[model samples]
Target: MALNVALLRASFEVVATANPRFVHRFYEVLFERYPQTRPMFPASGMARQEEMLTGALIAVLDHLEDAPWLTETLGALGAKHVGYGVTREMYDWVGASLLATLAEVAGSAWTPELNAAWTEAYGAIVSLMLARAAT
Candidate 1:
């Protein structure tokens, strides 16, 4: 869990270093592939878009010390997203696309350590969220 937190922090640092062009590229690639997610975002701008991504990175990193807290937070996040028409299936798409973007940005710097950490972290996130949905 600590490693997962470190990875989230490290990945966000890499992402934050990117120019705005990279953000646009990421959104473009994601939305183009899954047009259905477009409506979940602001139709007119990227303000909330940046917040959501940045917030998720920070939240995940900040909560690594407490897996239960991470699970709870992600459950709330999932519930909110559900209101936006984001289904459980959609989370899988989000994970894939976000990881792809990270890999693209990190290039050679993306190692097994980071990959495994993020994978485990995201798994926990999704599991808790789905568990919440069942409740």
Candidate 2:
């Protein structure tokens, strides 16, 4: 399925503007829902991790139309995950937590359409990541 790039960008802007701690909330929701994933992260506080995630989200949303860049970036990222010990299954948990956090942060701006847009975008991202990971 194609991603609703416009909706994804607009909804992400709304969430980012509404809550500056969007990635923090995502990690909180992820850890809360799937405590086992916590060990995969650093305990020194999540500042760096949060920054990386926020940058990645913005990069993906901003470049949704650029397939070559997306493939190169996400492919390398997926390959890097192997060193981090990220399982293919963790992508699903991360996607769920991210969408839930976005919904909560977007508040009144959140819609079923927006949810589907994000879901589709995330699925495409995970597919690229996992395909590279398997290599």
Candidate 3:
């Protein structure tokens, strides 16, 4: 299914004001659900990682129509992840954690449709990442 960009963007805006907490919640869920992945990140770089994640989300959302830029940027990010020992399987864990965090942050605003949209978007991103990794 195609991404519901408008819905995803609107839902994101609803939780944008709580970005810091959202990012924190994301990592909290991710680590809690998949403790094995925790070793991949350093304790000292969480703040910077949060900033980069938020920035990357905004960049991806804003430039969703720019396929070339998105592909290059996300591919580069995927290539970088290869050096960090990120496996393709980890993408599923991250995606689930992300959706859970979004639901927690969005509270009553979260719906099945919104969840599906984000899932689709995340799948697209992971596909790009995996594609890059395969090269």
Against the true structure, candidate 2 reaches a TM-score of 0.96
Looking at model 2, the pairs that clash are none
**Per-model C-alpha lDDT, please?**
0.73, 0.89, 0.86
Order of the predicted models by TM-score, top scorer first: 2, 3, 1
By TM-score, how accurate is candidate 3?
Answer: 0.93
1 or 2: which has the higher TM-score?
Answer: 2
Evaluate candidate 1 by giving its C-alpha RMSD to the native, one decimal: 2.5
lDDT of 1 by residue, 47-68 (tens): 6786677667677677778877
Clash totals for all candidate models = 0, 0, 0
**Model 3, C-alpha of 45: deviation from truth (Å):** 2.8
Stretches > 4 Å off in candidate 3: 18-20
RMSD of each: 2.5, 1.2, 1.6
The per-residue C-alpha lDDT of model 1 at residue 9 equals 80
**TM-score to native of every candidate shown:** 0.81, 0.96, 0.93
Q: What is the lDDT of residue 41 in candidate 1?
A: 83
